[model samples]
Target: MHLDQLNQQYGLPELSFGDRQRGFPVIKIKNRFATAEISLYGGQVLSFQPSNTQADLLFLSDRSHYRPGKAIRGGIPICWPWFGADPDGLGRANHGFARDRLWTVRHTETLANGATRVILSLQDDEETHKIWDYAFELAIAVTVGETLDLELTSHNRDQRPMTITQALHTYFTIGDIQRVKVLGLAGLDYIDKADQEKLKQQIGEVTIQGEVDRIYQNTAPKLFIDDLSLERKIEVCNRNSTTTIVWNPGMEKTATMGDLSPDAYQRFLCVETANAAAETITLAPGERYTLGITYRLL
Candidate 1:
């Protein structure tokens, strides 16, 4: 299906509940330079564009095949405060409250550069505080320009300090996961999720296989995703985030995702620039921290 048709069928006029829970809203923002649609529910980027071309879909949503009750099939799923399953973590869910809450559209302003930025903010509410006690605020400003810019800020308002791990958790669309190569994480120390204590030294390009999940530590500022099928390079540049997560659930795990097609594993790969593992950020009372990832098409 075309991007616009997908939006017309699923896009929201205002905030509304999605599959998983109650009180979430789907928000859409657009301007002359680009059109971006996102749901405050999962903070999922439904569609992004640079000039009229579709930039990213993040996931593949297939209602016909459902696994988890309300989870959508495709589009990026925002993993914040924690990346994957954190059974020992404070919250009951795998990821934190950032993606599940309804975010208010704070403002949308046109920049001097002729680009438009849509700012969305979500604060911890009664429902959130019940699970996680931190009084926090999250602001995400999506700047639509020649390339897409995502600025994420987390503010701690409580009297005590809090430490948390976060990630933009992007599922970049590709021609084939096997044909794609990720660059810029060489010679770094990473804990192979397949084996926790065994730190594998990253020496060359990244290749995905059997339940791959690793946190690349003290990484450089830039990473590249070369998609051979699309004949395009996605340059991912990070600001404020120190760690990068490269993951794909592979064949067996892909079956667990209800919204994903059995063949979905072949079409996408996640090269998430994150602040997880040992890089958990500590926010003092009233202090705020920011992390950004910019996607430039080459």
Candidate 2:
């Protein structure tokens, strides 16, 4: 939609539009409770900071690509249809095409409690068929308030049943990786992607020391990030998500990524809410599934 039409239909006093570094359209939300920025190119929430906090709850890379076709380095990237490497060896993008396409702003509203709600959607088209030949509709509703809440819904628009793996790949800001501890995943089986996909059991609260990439299976509904450097406990709660992925590309791997700084791994953490591996979902014709997440400081 054009700028004028978007402003006419969905604009509010606290919401406006601006261009990113490379001309990607971004929706800015500055309400009474918090401030946020959403990029139209990926339908990604790039920044969200509550009014009472001194730091942003999310993280965005300084060297992230702000152009089309390439996924940004941080914040929340919607990995749909599939997650991680090409599951079928199709040589497709690692985390699916949803994050590389433009999304339409479907709706916006200001809640009674002064929170701002914006809904962005992507639907199947001829171009999407070229990548994954399934008719589908995906929508993400973002509520910016004292807390940041996200609800991603997928609707099967085809005749046949569809099975898929997906994730809300959220990158959160931290004072220091070494001083952070993740709680509520103490005793679950995890697939260690960094250790040759070995299956292991968690022994205690997770801590970041070096390269850590594991997908915890059959996860609980909530987790917490205790940041000693920041002196805050951040809550991560989700619904309809059975897996949680914790990843930190250590100094060695971070050097190979063009979009991240050499020492970027020390300042961020990825605790993804997902349906992956043994937790894949199958949707019958016309069925819909929603994965919800909420983040707040406690």
RMSD of each: 5.4, 0.9
Encode model 1's per-residue lDDT on 96-196: one tens digit a residue. 65666556666656677876666777888888787677788888887766777888888999899988788888877877778888988878889888676
lDDT of 2 at 7: 82
Root-mean-square deviation of candidate 2: 0.9
The lDDT for every candidate, in the order shown, is 0.71, 0.93
- In terms of TM-score, the best-performing candidate is 2
lDDT of 2 by residue, 184-282 (tens): 999999999999999999999999989999999988999999999989899999899989999999999999999999999999999999999888899
User: Against the hidden reference, what TM-scores do the models get?
Assistant: 0.84, 0.98
As for candidate 1, its clashing pairs are 16-25, 58-75, 58-76, 59-74, 59-75, 60-73, 60-74, 61-73, 61-74, 67-258
Least lDDT summed over 10 consecutive residues: which range in candidate 2?
17-26
lDDT of 2: 0.93
